[model samples]
Target chain A: MAQMADKGETFPATVENRGGTGRIVLCCEHASNHFPAGWGDLGLSAEQRLAHIAWDPGALALSRRLSASLKAPLVHAPVSRLIYDLNRPPFSAGAMPARSEIHDVPGNATISAQERAARMRAIYLPFHTALHDLLAERMALGLDPVLVTVHSFTPLYFGKRREVEFGVIHDDDPSLARAIVKAAASTGLRTGLNEPYSAGDGVTHTLKLQATPYGLPHAMLEIRNDLIHDDQSVARMAELLTPVLNMGLAEIQRQAKAS
Target chain B: MAQMADKGETFPATVENRGGTGRIVLCCEHASNHFPAGWGDLGLSAEQRLAHIAWDPGALALSRRLSASLKAPLVHAPVSRLIYDLNRPPFSAGAMPARSEIHDVPGNATISAQERAARMRAIYLPFHTALHDLLAERMALGLDPVLVTVHSFTPLYFGKRREVEFGVIHDDDPSLARAIVKAAASTGLRTGLNEPYSAGDGVTHTLKLQATPYGLPHAMLEIRNDLIHDDQSVARMAELLTPVLNMGLAEIQRQAKAS
Candidate 1:
């Protein structure tokens, strides 16, 4: 067991895996707000630098806790989503956004065609390849892989306060999502079937590419960032989510075998 | 008739008109291949920097001569097409191309949504707004405006040599296009009525946004760079094109009067 999977920060997008034999794979694509210092904070003010436009604040921390709890491998992107959103496809406009909410990214204001291709090669391709390779290796080893991407959303968007605390996002597969939502409801979490963000809004790039093609049991969790901001809260949330995920996967397998 | 039109490079895209009372308006959107100094030459080698990938070579030079003879307004984008193609809409992938032919733009490789919006605000929107305002202002003054965009293409693309020396591109406007094609063919020039590129291929963002919505007589002229790579070639080509454009506009006007 390789303890951790760090493909390096130079490539921007990287993964840190706590080596485990579990079939559940946890992915945190927007895991950090660390843009390589070469970008000069992406020409953002200090306030904007720490804003949700840069990264989902508590997602990585929560995913780490869950990964540890479930004994699952976590593949994460180390660069800021402001640098390149790993959750978006190379052709997606949001993959390399020019604006998010009210803030603007000045560094990407006027780029050349050559510069675009370089980022695709350096950050985007590497991160996706690593995830794909990891999943492929597990399948080759005769282990079933369940894909789960951990995410956190802002409680407010465009000045509108969001209502749901937990969102179960999926692509064409509803078994895992429905199960997680059902269990989370029992835990008293204000759960949404696909509220806050829908998979149709082009938010499922990672899951669509990695999970749908393989027909793997997959679901992306969008927790409210405010709830998981602290370490204790993250751990507590993980504890609540771990049992749900395990049960959800067990049910999926049971149904698969029955079918 | 005013003699010259050059709006400078500070705002990047601006209108320079000779203040001619004629209905014809000239534009050279991919006019310059001059990417500003800050982006580290977009990670392109010196050779690649000067190639057609940076800008449509000879397009601006030819436009200058055409503007001189036509005595019409010429709107231009001073930044390199490699930076942000002014001929394309902000949402178009080619607007900030990550890849151009075999060359890739490193600067645009990993842009943020903020960056995309910045480019739109800084480069894309400004150019379109200026052009739109120019047309609106002319119409406001009770003057009919005929839009004409100037462009140049490579003789060889992807290792294959091309035959057409000129392409008259249009956006659903057949009157001006038919006139230009007939006039161009009469001059012993090998002309293609929308060859190498078609307006349907998303290449007519300028004409679509500026021309079609207004039902103005408009057409895009695509000259071969090999045919106008230098001062002598540019002058000769301009000399051949001037009378054709004047005659084309006259025919359009005549047809309008009859219809």
Candidate 2:
């Protein structure tokens, strides 16, 4: 898996799978928390820098730990989110954000059509291809893998405070979300059912394009940034969420058999 | 359509279709012939530089002419093929060509994931979305449009010359290809039966992905670059092709009625 950094230098992208028997594929779309060298700060202060707008901070650590603990394959994008957001549909208006928040993306403005095609060929296609290949391979091997995408949300957005500590988002398959919501409730943690964003808007990628098309059970877990700001917090959240994920997977299997 | 170019500069990469009624959707994946400013001249002499590798050479002009004459909506990519070959599958090995012929594409050597995703979003997706939207609109209006992709291929590749003046390539829809071949034969032009390339392999893109899924009749028209080098030639070819295409469309209608 560590070879991805080196391979990424030569190839456009890489997908790594740690050894696992469980049929749960883990993905972190905005995993990279590093900007390219010499980008010389995005012209934002330190506090303003670490917010959700910049990157999906701390989710990578939790995803890595979860992948290790569960022995499942993990697919992550190594580039900074500011460059291109993988979660947004390739044709979405927000795909190439010229001006994000108060900061202007100077690199993206006035790009030629050729330059745009080059970017898509190199990054977006590879990531989606890897995910597609992995799912196809697992399914071919008779493994009905459940996809779980890990992400983090900011405590506040646009000067408004967000009270949700955790969110369970699903567009089609409600089995996993229902399990997680129930588990979180039993643990006394207030969970939001698609609080930050609703899956009903028809704006989706990765999970929607890859998983939903196959009718596979999947869920997007959004943990508030404040909840996973540090290593200890990340580990604690992983531990807390582990059982919920496991139970959800088991219930998915049970439901699949029942149907 | 004129409104599009003016608005495109301000809202670049936005996609809108020409409102239409014809039951034929024209697509030109490699429509734009552009190179980034200052590409060190690609190290090729003028003759080799002007070859089909730089672009599809004359496809966009022909497609526009066909769209106008046939009153069919056309969906085209505004980016250079060198940036990302829109005709190739997003994840196909050739999606981002590192080297074309002997000319080295220096800019493509080490693209970051972020830059790649940006390209997919900015160019590839918009082209496909435009085509998909046009098809969906036609379907909604109860128009069973046959997809006709217009492309121009080089007269020769490597060292051998291609004798065929035109090729009608189709995979599952042999009915359309058979009709076009018969029509072209009736005109006494030497046509290649999937010459230059085969639909069985090395053939994919929006046409296959978008059209085949809907079971719509589709065929790709590959005219040798030598045949369509000038405006007169393109007009001549389009004139010859209109009857052939119409014959194929009629055959498809017959098949639909029979089924």
Candidate 3:
């Protein structure tokens, strides 16, 4: 509540299904492109504001569906990644990037250090700290939480088409990701291990920061944006990915027990 | 002392001429190329370690000379800028850059959020906080401290030779910078206003952060590295710049009194 007052009308993040008994902790870092009342479109055109550069299109809807079906807790950022990317560490340039693809974020171009620090305190720190605390609480309760961040990538990057429909990305430990990749074989969906983006691309910051340090099983699920643009598609995709996620979770549990 | 033990032998920053009785505060953000005990060259070759990318070649010596000549206090970072650039906010990518020009910093490429935060606490925050506190102390003493950051740039960048020998860069207000430029006309040295680099290049962070909000007069001095690479040259450059700096300070003081 104090955080809301600190930065006017911005909520750092929201958590739904917090009491869910599932081990999976779903994260949607780039869930919305909603600019808070004070931050005036960040000098973006209407088309640019709705672009994937602002936030991942259809990511929140799909994440909500997955949260429901998996009965898992969902932690999602409520503002545009343009304001502060929850996935990136505050030290990273990408966290408050001045430019993304072809769009120049006029507002971010010359942000003073004090303003930058304010946003970090108001948004980035609260979001990650809350998630970290939630994970710790679950671990204390004898629940081994699996970090599964959901995202949607543009079907075309730099004007080139991306063929991989589903990306199961991992960093450091790969057991959960490998399991997910294997589970995808039954559905005949086009799945790739760390496709479109990889750990080397600095896309796995959330996993590396929150999950790897705890040695918890984790995987970042990146679906092609075009595939989940509408409600029907989002629901269908969630339905398809649900069993695969369950299988992966079961396999990781079995492996953990064996070890 | 606790800071050294916490990070295994890294001094966050050092304050020289701390009790100097002058209204000017000198800062050298990239003062050393000394990587502390544990950081291990940040995965660079011997030549790359000594390159301008690691640290400003003779900026510290110049800053020290100016500190003595002008009776101003100086605050400087002791570790390499490659570890953490003190002039940048922690959120900016350049603060702990993964790459500098053609050099790839292997150590910075995959830094975790925790590690980034640790470096900020160890390096960036301490340096800036010390400078901030010093300014506050000066103001409390009725000493209207003027912020002057000293830095040096490479002679050749991306295989192209730079022509500007002296650069007076500013942001928001250019009164002090203009005075310095006006004073430079008496000397035969070639000078440019916001040349080589400018506020657009994100080089004025120190001025904007430390001085602008308080309406303190500030200017960042950029010397071509070749001019100040050795002791004799550093002393000579300092001598030439001190009068110009003094004149600028006098002119700003007159303007301040008039207002």
RMSD of 1: 17.2
- In Å, candidate 2's interface RMSD is 12.6
Clashing pairs in 2: A116-B119, A119-B116, A120-B119, A120-B120, A123-B116
Scoring only the A-chain of each prediction against the true A-chain gives TM-scores of 0.93, 0.87, 0.95
Off by over 4 Å in 2: A1-16, A37-49, A201-203, B1-259
**What tens-digit string does per-residue lDDT give for candidate 1 at B102-164?**
787887686654455455555665676567656655653447789999988889999999999
Q: Considering lDDT, which of the candidate structures 1 and 3 is the better prediction for this target?
A: 3
Q: Write the per-residue lDDT of candidate 3 for residues B141-220, one digit (tens) a residue.
A: 44678999999999899999998899999977899999999999988888999988898888887776667645579999
Candidate 3 residue pairs in clash (backbone atoms < 3 Å)? none
lDDT of 2 by residue, B192-222 (tens): 7777677656664555556754557788888
- In model 1, how large is the Cα lDDT of residue B252? 86
Tens-place lDDT digits, model 3, residues A21-46: 89999999999898876666778888
Angstrom error at residue A15, model 3: 24
The stretch of ten residues in a row with the least summed lDDT in candidate 2 chain B is B1-10
Return the TM-score for candidate 3, rounded to 2 decimals: 0.51
**After TM-score superposition, what is the CA distance of residue A255 in candidate 1 from its true location, in Å?**
1.1
Q: How well does each candidate reproduce the native contacts, as fnat?
A: 0.00, 0.00, 0.00
The model with the greatest lDDT is 3
In candidate 1, which residue ranges exceed 4 Å CA deviation?
Answer: A1-13, B1-259
Q: What lDDT score is found at residue A235 in candidate 3?
A: 92
